[model samples]
Target: MAGDKELAGFILFLSQFPFLQAAKILTISFIGGSHYLLMDEISRILHDNGHQVRMFRQFGDGMLPGRQAQQSPYPVSTYSLGEKYLAEYKALFTEAQKDNLMGRDSLQNFLIFLNELSHQCNVTLHQSDILNFLKEEKYDLAVIDGFNPCCFLAAEKLGVPYIAMFPGTFMNAAKVGVTGPLSYVPIFQSLLTDRMDFLGRLKNTFMYLGSHIVDKKMDALFQKVIDEHFPLGSRPSIADLHLRAELWIYNIDFSIEFPRPLLPNIQCIGALLAKPAKPVTQELEDFIAESGDSGFIVVTLGSMISSLPLVEFLKEMIDGFAKIPQKVIWRYKRSEWPQGVNVAHNVRLMDWVPQNDLLGHPKARLLVTHGGLNSLMEAVYHGVPVVGIPLFGDQYENMVRVKAKNMGTFIPPDEMKAEKFASTIREVVENGCYKTSAMKQSVILRSRPFPPDQQLLGWVEHIIQSGGGGHLRPYSYQQPWYQQFLLDVILFLSACVAAIIYLILRVIRALIYFISNRKQKQN
Candidate 1:
C-alpha cells in the first residue's frame, strides 16, 4: 500500500469562520437508486441548513426536492439506465433472486457483481462527469452515501472535502475503523430462531468477509478505470483513491441507536424527522375512527420493495383480512382490489395512504411492514408494534432489531403462510405486549427536546470553517494488513530452523574430533 491515498474526512471543526457570510455546499448523493425516501430527508436537511445544494440521483426521472425540473442534478443527466445496462442488471438481479444468494456460497458472487456495477457508476463513468461539472461550477463541499465511493473520488481529485453517510445500520464501517453502529444482528437468526444456527453463523461470517472483498475489488476496479482514463505514465494507487471526507454525517440519533463511541468526524443527526410532516388528509382519519372495538392495522412496504412484485401474495393477505375483526388500511399500488376481495366491510385499501398519519391515529393498532428504515422510524415514532415480513437485504436484520426491542414480530417471506400471518397479526394487535413495547420506544424518541436538522447544519458549517477535517484525519500508523501480524510467526519459525542447523554443525565437529582422538589412541 505504498503511496496509498490518504482518505479525507474528520470531525467538522466549528470555531474558525465568521458566521455572517453564507457558504456554498455542493452535494452529490445517490447509492444506485433514488427509490430510498431517506435521501429526501437528507436533501431536506441540507436545504434547511442554507447551503447551496446540487444533487445527482439515479434510477428515477422525477425532480429532486430542491431543484427545478428543467435543469436536473447532474451536468448532463439522463434518468434512463440505457436499455443494455437495464437488461444486464435485471438479468443479474433475477439470477441472484432465483439462486437465493441469501444462502451460502453464491452470496459472494452476487456481491461482486453488485460492487463492480456500483464501481462503474461511482468511480469510472459518474466520477469524471461530476468532476468536469464541478470544475466549471465549483462548490465548497460534497456529501454523499458512504458505500458509493466513486462520488468521493471526484471530491478527492477536486481537493474538496466530502462526507460519506450511511443510511441505516451498516456493519462494516465499524470494522473499517469508521465510527457507527455495526449491525448487531445474530447470524441467520430469522423469525423462528433466537440466535443464528451453525450454517447461519457460517454464512454471516462469510458475508462479513465478503463485503471487504467487494470493497477491495471495487478499489481495484476503480484504479484500473482511473489508470485507463488518465494513464499518467504512472497511476495513483487505488488506496490513494478511496479517502474519507472532512466530516462524516450519520443520519441517526444516539438516543435510539445508543452506546456508540463518539468520534469527532462522525456526527449523528438521525432525529431530523422527529417533528415529522402532518397528515395530509382528514378523510383517512374518519375511516380509522370507524374501526371501533378492535382498532385498525396498517400495512406498508417501503419504496424499493415493489407492491407490484408482491401482488399475488397480496391475494392471500386479502383473504386473511376477511378473517380478522380489526380493520386494515393497506398502502397499496392500485386504487382498488380485484372485484371479489372487496367484500370485507372492515377493510379499506387505497393505492396510497398517508402512513405516518394513519399510524398516529388513536385507533391504529398493529403494523405489517417490509421493515425499511423509514417505516421502522415511523413505527417507532408512533409507538406502534410491527409484524415485519422482510423481503430482502437488510430488511430481515432491521426487523430482528424491532423484535429484540419487544416492539415487533417478523415473518420472512418464505415462511409467510396465510393462516400463520393473520394469526400473528391478530396476536400482536390483541395482546398487550407489542403495544407496551411501542409506547416505550415512543418515549425514547420524544424524550429528546432538540431537532437534529440544526445539528446537521452546524456540522456541515464546521467542516467548511475548519479548512478540511484536521481533527478527525487519522495519522498513518493505523494502516496494516490483517496477515502482516503473522510475519512474527514467520520470523519465529526461521529462528527455530537456524537453531537446528547450529546443533547439527556442533555434533558433526564433535564427532570428527572424537574419531581423531580414537585414532591417535590406537597409534
Candidate 2:
C-alpha cells in the first residue's frame, strides 16, 4: 500500500513539470579537435540536465590518441575509418600546413578534404552493425555535427528529429532558407567585414555567387552516399536534409559576429566554453609571480599546427618573444622543436597550457593565437586583447573580425618577421584602447539575458517538449527557389507592365491614324 502511494505521488509530480521528463539523446561527432570538444560539452550539459545522452564518435587516422581515449560521463560508441582514408585525411592537413607556411594558397587542400569526408561517409553507412545498434537505441532526438553531412544521413536513417550544431558562423544559411544580403553581410571566407566599400561589396557579391558553385559540388559528392543508402525514388537531396533540421545552434554571437538576420529556430551560444577562471598550478603561479608588473602573454597556434616543425616560423616567434618583456607561455610540443633554435629565457614552452585559466587570470596581458573561433571567444570572455597569426581555414576570417572590432590585429605568415611580430604584440599590449575594446566585448557577451549553457538547455528542452521544431520552422524553407527569392513575382509584375505599355501604344497609334484620315478627307 505504501509503494502504491509513492508511485501515485511520483506521477503527480511529473505532471506538474513536463520539462523534467528525461529525453534519450544521440549526438553524432565525426570530426575531432575542437569540433569534438564542442560536441562533448553539449553532451555533458544534456546529461547533467536529466537527459540520457550518448555520443557516437567517428575516428579518423590522424586523430590524437588522447582525444580518442578520453572518457566521457555518458555512454560513447566509436567508429574508425579505413586506415588508408584516415591516413590521407591526416596527410592533407600536413600538406595544407606546408602550403600556409610557405605563404601559398591552400584552396586545393579544402577540396581534397571534402572528397575524403564523402568517402568516410560511404564507409560509415556500410556498417550495418552500427546502424542497427543506433536504431535499437530509439533515441528521442539527435544532435548532429553540422560540419559533416554524414551525420545528417545517420539521423535521417533513424527517423529522429535533429538539431545541427555548427561550430562557427552559419556560412550555409541559404541551404536552410536563411539569406544574408551580399551588400553588407560578408560571405564565409571572403575575409570581408560587415562594413564594406564599393569594391569590397563587388568582391563579396562575386564570392556569394561562387559559394553556390561550391555548394553544388559538395552536394554532388555526397549524393552518391545518399543514392546507395537511401531508396532510389525516396532519396532526399543533401540540402533537403539540412532544411529539415529542427534548430541550428551556431557557435557564434553578435558580440563577435556582425549583426545579421536570424531565423526563429536558429540560436547563437558562442560562449559555451567560457567560464570563470580556476586557480593555476603551483609552478604556473610561481612563473606569474616572477613576471611582476610585466604580465605574461598566452600563445597557442591551435592543436594541428602546434605539432608541425615550422623551423623558420618558430625561430621568428622565439626571437619575438625574446624582445618582449612579458613572460610567454606557448603551447608547443617540445619533441617537435627545431634542433638549432635556442629557447628564449622568459618563454615557457609546454605541450599544453591551461589556456582559458591563463587568459582569465588578472596578469594575462595579451593572447597570441591562430585565430580559431574557440580561442577568440575565450579571449573575448576574459577581456584579453589579441595578436593573431591566422594559419588556415576560417582563422583568417576570424582575425578579420578581431581587427574590425579593434580588439587586436593580425600578422600574415608572409609578413611574419620577428620585428614585425614583436611590434604587433607590443602594440596590442601597450595600447589601452585594445584592452578597453576587448573588455567592452566581454561585457556585451556576458550581459546576455541567459548564459550560454542555460540557453542551450532551455531551447533543447523546448524542442523536445513541443515535439520537434515545426512551430518554429519558417515557411520559406518549403518554397521553391524562385518563389523564396520572389523572382517569379518580379517576373509576373514585369510581364503585366509590359503588356499594359504595349496596349497603350496600340490605342495611341489607332487615334493617330483616325485623326490623319479625318484631315485627309476634309482636304
Candidate 3:
C-alpha cells in the first residue's frame, strides 16, 4: 500500500540519526500572523526530520498571505472563529490605536478582551472536530502558543505532554523570574530600559506588582471557562500547565533584549523563521536599480495594524515620504485608500510587501517599522537600521531597546509629525553610526553556537527522546514563590533576631532593677 511505503521511507530516513526518533508533533496557534510563522517553522523543522507533524491554525481573513503556510510539508487543519469574533478583535485593536495613557483601566480592559477571546476559542474548539483528530493522530508532543489558553486546554484533553512557544519577548514575568532584583527588570508593556534610575526602579516594582495582579485575575477568568468546558473533574490551572511545559522557546535574543536569568528549560531561538533571502521580482528589482545611489526605505507597520483611524496620520506619512528623495515602499492594509492625497512618484503603496527580501536588497538603506518582534528580528538579520514608530504593547519596549543599542531612534506615535518624522529619517539614513551598530548586532546575533533551526531541532528531539526532559526543570518551579526567593528564610531570621533583642533587653532591665534596690537598702 502507499501508506506502508510512506511509513517505510520515514523509518529508513530516521535511521540516519540513530539516537533520535521521529515524533508526532502538533503545533497549535491562533489569531496572530507572527504566531503562525513561528509555529509553521516549528512544524517544518519537525517534518523535515522525518517526523509526523500536524498543525491546527485559526482561519480568518486580514492575515498577510505571505505569512500563511504555503506548501507545508506536513498536514494542516484549520479552525474558524467566525466573523463576530473577528469584528470584536478589530474593535479591540481600534480601541488600542487611540493611544490613551496605559493605566490600570487600560490594562483591565485588555485583560477582559483576552478573556473574551478565550471564550471564543473555547467555543470554536468545542464546535470543531479537534478532539477526534487528536484521538486519531496519537501525537507524541504538543507545541502550543503560551499566550492563549485554548490550545493548552486541547492538549490537556488529549492527554499529551507539550511544550509552550512564546513568539515574542517575555510575557510572564512571574513564570520566568528573569535577572536582577525585581526593581531592575521592567514589566510587560513597560516602555522602559533595563538601566533604571531611582524613580524608574520604583515604577518598575509597581509595574511588576500590577502585572502579577492582572495575570492572577486573568487566570481566574480563563479557569472559569476551562471548568465549563472540561467539567468532568478537577483540571490543572493554567499556571500549572505553564510550569509543567518541558521546555520554553523564546523568539528573542540577549543581544537585543536585556540579559535575564533563564531557566534550564528555556531557550532563545531568535530569527529562526527567516530563510535565506530570495531575490525580488524583476519589477521590484528594476525599481530599486533605478533608485541608484539613493537607496529606498522599506516602511511597514506590521500585519496587525491594518488601517489608520486618523486621516492626519496617513497624510503625515505620505507627506514625509513625498519629501524624501529615496524611493519608498509603504505596505499598508486598508480596504479603501484615503482620497484627496497626492502620492509622489518616488513613493509606492501596496497591500503587502516582500519585507525580508527587500530588507536584504543591496539598494535598501533603512527600515521604518512599528517594532514588532518579527519585523525587528528580520531587520537585524539583514543588518539594516530602523526608525521605530512604536504604537502599543511590546512595540514600545522593542523600540526602547533599538534606541538603547544605538541601532535607531524611537518616535512615539502620539508625538509623530511630518517634519520631525522626515528629519529623524534623514538623521538615521545619513548617520553611519546607526548602520555600524546594526551590523555589529547582526554579527552577534549570528554568532550562536549553532544555527537557530538546528539548535531548535536538537532541543525538540531531546525533549521527545528524554520523555519531556523532566530533569531540565528547575527545582524552583516546584517551590513556593516565598521559598524560591528566600523571603521565608529572611523572615524567619528577622524573627529570631527580634526575639534575641527582646530577651537581652529584659535581662538588662532586671540587672538595673536589682542594682537600684541594693543601693537603696544600703542608704
Candidate 4:
C-alpha cells in the first residue's frame, strides 16, 4: 500500500509538465555551402530535442569554408561521386564568374548547373545500397533541402511525408498556394520593395510572369531524372511533388523581408543559425579591444567567393579600407592579394573569422558583406549596420531589403571607386540613424512571441503528432490554375456583362424603329 502511494505521487509530479514523444527524423541534403548548414542545423535541433535524427549527406564540390573539418554529433550517411564530377562542378562556378565579368548573360550557365544537379540525382538514385539503407531505416519523417529538387525525389521514393526547408525567400510561394500580389509583393530577383511606383509595378509584373517560365524550365530539367528513375505511370510532376510537402519553412524574417501574406502550412524560421555570441579567441579579443571607441568592422563576401577576380576592384576595396578610422577584419585569402598592393594600416585580413561571434561583440560597429541571406540575418540578429557589395544571384535582391530597412546601403561592383566605397561605409557607420534602425529591428526580432527554435520545434512536433499537415493545407493547391487565380470566374462575369449590354442595345434599336414607323403611318 505504501509503495503504490509513492508511485502515484511520482506520476502526479510528472503530470505537471507537458509530455513530448520522440520522433525518428531523416534529413536529406545533397548540396553544400549555406544549404548544408541550414539542413545540418535542422538535424541538430531535432536531435537535441530527444528525437531520433539521422543525416544523409551527398557530397558535392565547394563545401563552406571552415566547415570542411567540422563533424556532426548525430549519425551521418555520406556518399560522393568521383573526382571527375567534383572537377566539373568547380569549373562551372569559374565559367559563371567569367561570364559575369565579361557582361555576358549568365542564365545559360545557371541552366547548366541545374542540369548537373539533375545528373547527380540520376546517379544517386541508381545506388542500390543507399536506397536499401534508407528504406531499412523507416524514418517517421524527412526534412529535405528545398533548393535541391533531388531531395524531394529521394523523399518520394522512400514514401515518407517531408517538410521543405528553403534557405532563401519563397519566390515559388505560389506553388504552395500562397498569394503574392505583384502590385505590392515584389518578385524575387526584381529587387523592388513593398512600396513601388507605377514603373516599378510594371517591371514587377513582367518579372512575376517570367518567374513562372523559369520555374517551368527548371522543372523540366528535374523531370528528366524522375522519368528515368520512377515508373512511367507513377511519375509525379515536380510542381505537384512540391505542393505535396507537409510544410514549407522559409529562411526569412519580416525584420529583413518585406511584409507578405503566408499560409498556415508555411513558416518563417529565419536566422536559425543566429544565437548568443561566444567569446572570441584571445588574439581576436585583443585586436577588437584595441579599436577603442571607433569599434571594429567585420568584412566577408560570404563563404563562396573569398577573393575579388579583378585586380582593380581589389585595389579599390583595399584603398577604401585605408580611409576608414575603425579597424577592419576582412576574410580574404592572403595568397590572392596582389604582390604590389599595400595593406591598409587599419585592416586585418584573415582566412576566416568567427563571424557571428564578432558581430555579436560589444565593440563591433559594422559588417561589409556580399548581401547573402545568411550574412544579412546574422547582421540583423546582432544589430550591426551593413555596407553590401553584392556579387551575384539573390545578393542584389537581398541588398534591396537592407536599403529599404534603412539599416545600410550598397555599392554596385561596376561602379565602385575608392572614394565611393569609403564614403558609403563611413556614412553608414557614422550615422546614428542606421545603427538605431538595426537595433530596433533586432529588438523586434528577439521580442517575437515564439523564438525561432521554439517555432521550429513546436510546429514540427505538431505536424508529426497530427500525422501530416493536410489539416493546415489550403485547397487552393488542388484547384486548376484558372480557378485558383479566379480567371474562370472573371471570364464568366465578363461574358454575362457582354450579353446584357448586347440585349439592351437591341431593345433600344427596336424602340426607335417602332416610333419611326408609327410616325410615318400617322402622316
Candidate 5:
C-alpha cells in the first residue's frame, strides 16, 4: 500500500508538464482476441484521460474475446476479412498441431496465413469507408498494432504521428528493425537462454539469422502493399516505417524475459493492460468450494489455439486428470471436442472460462496452458504454477523461461503421453518448489517502482508532448543500414590493408631483379 501510494505521488509529480492536454487518439487492432484486448485497454485509458479515443478492428459474429462487440466502450469501426480466409486460418492451426511448429510444413502454413492477412489489411486500409473516415477525422495520434504494417501506412497517409503497441515481447518481421545484440538475445521460438556457451551462441546466431530469411516472404508481401499505396512521394521502406514509430509499448516485462538492452523509445507495460479477474458466478464458486483441501486446476490454450482438437492429446489430458484427486476445469469448444475421451466426474469442460479470474482463485492449484504471453502474465500476477503445452509462436520460448525460473514445467505435445502428462501435472501440484518460485517471482513483477497504469500514461503522454519521442529516438535510426552495421568502417580498413600488401609485393620484386642483374655481371 505504501509503495503504491508513493508511486501515485510520483506520477502526480510528473503530470505537471505544460504539454499534458487532451488530444484525439485513433487506435487499430486486426485479428487475434488477445491483440484486441491490449488495444481496448489502451483506448480506455486514453478515453478516461479526457482524450477522444476511437478504435478500428475486425468483428464477426462471436469474434471478440470475452464480450460482444456492442459492449465495447470506444467508438469502434469494425471490418471483416470475409469467410474465405477463415477456413485458411483454421487449417493453419490444424497443421500446427499435427507437425512441430518449428518444422518446414508448419512454417509454410503460417506464411500462407501471413500473406492472406496482408492482402486483407490492404483492402481494409483502402476501403472507401475506413480510409475516408480516417482522412476526415485527422486524429492527433494513432496507436497501431506493431505487427500490422498497413496500420503504419494508414497513419502516415493521415499525417498523424503514431505509436506501436505489441501484444507480446516483439515477434514478426518488425523485429528485424529492433533486433538487439545477437550474442545474448534469443529470437522467438529459438528456445535459447541469454546465458550461453560457445556452441549455444553459435546456434542462437543461426536461429536469429535464419528467422529473418524465413520471414522475407511475409516482408515482401507487406512491402508490395505499402508500395502500391505510398508510391507518390519520397517513400520509406516498410522497415523504416517501423523504426519511425514515436514509441513502442510491449506486453512483456523484465521479470519473465531474458536480460537484453533496449532502445529508449521502447516501454515494457506487461500486465498493466490486463484487467483484474472479475468475480466468478456462485454456481462455479460452489463447484470449486466442493473440491475441499485439494484445490482445482485450470486448463486453457488461450483464445486463439484453444479450439484445436488433437485427438490423442485430449485423451491423454483426460486420462491424466482422471487419476488426480483435484477437480479440473478445461476450457474447450464442445463442437470440436473428441468423443473418444471420457470425462471423469472430477473434470468439467466449458467452451469459454474466465481464465485470469480462475487463476486468481485461492482454490486454483495450477494452470495448464499454451504459454501465450497474456496467460503467462495472469499466472504470474496471481502466483500460480504452470504446466505448459506450447503450440506455436513464442510459446516454446515462453515455456523455456518458465522452466528456467522453476515456476513450471512443459511437455512438447508430440512427446506427451497420458501417464507422463498426468505425472507432470502431479509434479507441479505436489512440488513446493514450483509454487514457492512463482510467489517469489510475483513479488519481483509487482515490485516495479512505478505502477503500470501510471507508467503507461506517463510515457504515452511524454511521446506526444515532446513532439514524437524527441531525443528518445536512437541516432542509429537516422544512419543508413551499412553505417549502422559498421560495414563502412570495415570497407575502409580492408582498403588500407590491401594497399600495404601491394606496396610490400612491389618492394620484393624490385629486390629480386636487382639481385639477378648482380649475378649476371659476376658471371
Candidate 6:
C-alpha cells in the first residue's frame, strides 16, 4: 500500500520517465559513506529485478572482499569485506591531514580536500591490479561516478552498457539538451528512525553499529579503489577519470528540487531512500517535549564540515539564538566551549545527533545548515524551514532550491556574521512565508503515492521482469568524450596555432637580421 502511494506521487510528478534497465550490470563504487549508500541501493534494485549484477564495491565491511571478487551472476553473490586496504587509507588521510597547507579554516581545508579527493579518486579507479579481480562475467550496462570516470574505460574494455550513478550532490546531471534533471533532488536515504541528542547519540555509538562508525570504516574500504588506479598522467587531473556511461543515474529526486535543467540520459533517483516499515523511537518524543514552546532549532554543518572548525560561526549562531527565547541544539564536535563565545542558555552541543528524528520533532522550528542534500530532504519531510549556509560541492546549488521555493534564507559561508545570523533566525521565525513554504514542501512529500523506497524497488523489479537490462541500452556508445567535446580538432588547432606563432617569430627574426646585415654592408 505504501509502495503504491510512493509510485503514484512520483508518477504524478515525473515529467518524463528514464530508460533505466540493465542486464549484467557492473555496478561499482569506492564504498565511501554516501557513495556506498547509492551503489548498494543500485545493486539491491538491480539484483531484486532479476538482472545479473556484478558489484565492485571497495568498502565491504568484513562481509565484502578486497582483491578477489565473488561472483553470483544472478541468483546470489557474496561481497565480503577485507582489511588489506586500511593501512593505505589511513596513510592517505594522514597525508591529507598533513598536506593541510590550509590552516584551521575548515572551509578552505574542505576545498583543498575536495581537490585532493578528485585527484586521489582518479588514481584509485584505474589500477591494473583490479582487472585481475574481474570475473569471466559480461556486463550489459555499467554505472560510474562523475568523481571517478574510470568506469567508462572499464565498460569499454568489458564491452557493455554504462551509466553514471552519482550519490553526491552535483548539477552536471541537469546540463543543456537533457531532460532528466526534472526529477532529481540530492539527499541521503536511510531507514533507521530514532531520536537522541548529540551526546546521547554519541553515547549510543558503542551500543549499536552506528551509521557514523560504519561510514568511517566504509570510507577506508572504498579508499583502496583510488590506491589501485591513481596518479593519471604525470600531472593529476580528474579529467583522467574520463569514464563514460550510456546513462547517468542520479541518487536524487525532483520533487524537493524544482526548476532543474532538463537533460537526456540523466535520471533522478533521489527518493531512493524512502523505504517501507520505518519505525519511530521514544527518545524522539522526549526531545520535542524538552523544547517547551518558542520551538527550538536544529543546527548542523554536516559531518564533512566540522563544528570545531566553524567555532566562530557556531558562536555567532548561538548568540543569535540567545537573543531569542528559542532553544538551539548544535551538533558541536568539541567537548568544551571556546573563549569569546558563550553557549546560549537554551543551547546544547554534542559530537553527533539523530538528525532525522530531530527534524521530525515538533520543536524543530527551523534548521540552520550547510545545505547538505540529506539534511535538506529531512527538513522538507517534516515541513521545517531552512536557513542554508552552503559551503561547497552541491551545497551551493542545493541552497538555490531553498531560496527558490521561498522555503528559507541562504547565508553564504563568508557572509555569516553574528548580526546577520541573529537577524536571519528571527526573520525565519517571525516570517510566515518560510513556514508556509515548508508546509507546502511537506504536502509535496506526503503527496507522493509511494514512499521513495517503493518507487526505487518497483523500478528495480520492472527492469528484472524484462530480462537482463538490454532495454536500457543506449542507441550506441560510439562517441567518445573527445568526440563529444570536439577536443581532437581542438588539439589540431592548438598545434596549428603553435606553428603559426613559431613561423611569425621566425619571420620577425629574419627581418631584424636582414636589416642588420644591410646596415653593415652599407657601412
Question: Which one is best on TM-score?
Answer: 2
Task: Please provide TM-scores, in order, for all candidate models, with all chains considered together.
Answer: 0.74, 0.94, 0.91, 0.93, 0.89, 0.60
Superposition TM-score, candidate 3 onto the true structure: 0.91
- Relative to the true structure, candidate 1 reaches a TM of 0.74
Candidate 3 lDDT by residue in tens digits, 1-523: 9999999999999887657667888888775667776788888888888988898877777455333435777887877777987788777766666543222235656676677767776765585476687768898898888777777777877788888888888867576544356556777776778888898888888887777777778778777677777755667787787787888888888768887677788888888755558999898888888788989999888775655666777778778877777898878653556777667788877677888899988888899998888899888888899998776567778898899999998787767778888898999999999999998988888787888889888888889887786898878777888997799999999999999999999999999999999999999
Sorted on TM-score, highest at the top, how do the candidates line up?
Answer: 2, 4, 3, 5, 1, 6
RMSD to the native, candidate 6? 14.2
lDDT of 1 by residue, 145-213 (tens): 665555655555555667666666544353335532224333322232235566765665666555666
For residues 162-239, what per-residue lDDT tens digits would candidate 5 score against the true structure? Answer: 888877766652353568777778776667777777888888788877887776666677777777777657665667
* Residue pairs whose backbone atoms clash in candidate 4: none
Q: 51-118 in candidate 2: lDDT tens per residue?
A: 99998888653444222256679998888886876677667767777677666656666767777888
List the pairs of residues colliding in candidate 2: none
- The CA-based lDDT of model 4 is what? 0.86
Task: Quote the lDDT for 13 in model 6.
Answer: 77
Candidate 3 has an lDDT of: 0.79
The weakest ten consecutive residues by lDDT in model 3 span 97-106
Arranged by lDDT, best first = 2, 4, 3, 5, 1, 6
lDDT of 3 at 68: 41
Over 4 Å off in model 6, which ranges? 1-27, 31-33, 40-115, 122-131, 134-143, 150-160, 168-170, 174-244, 260-264, 274-284, 334-342, 458-523
lDDT tens string, model 4, 99-213?
A: 5534343556668888998998988888778888888988989999988889999999988899999888766776667857888999877889999999999999998778888
Please give the distance, in angstroms, between residue 15's alpha carbon in candidate 6 and its true position after superposition.
31
RMSD of each: 8.7, 4.2, 5.9, 3.7, 4.9, 14.2
**Whole-model lDDT values for every prediction:** 0.61, 0.86, 0.79, 0.86, 0.78, 0.57
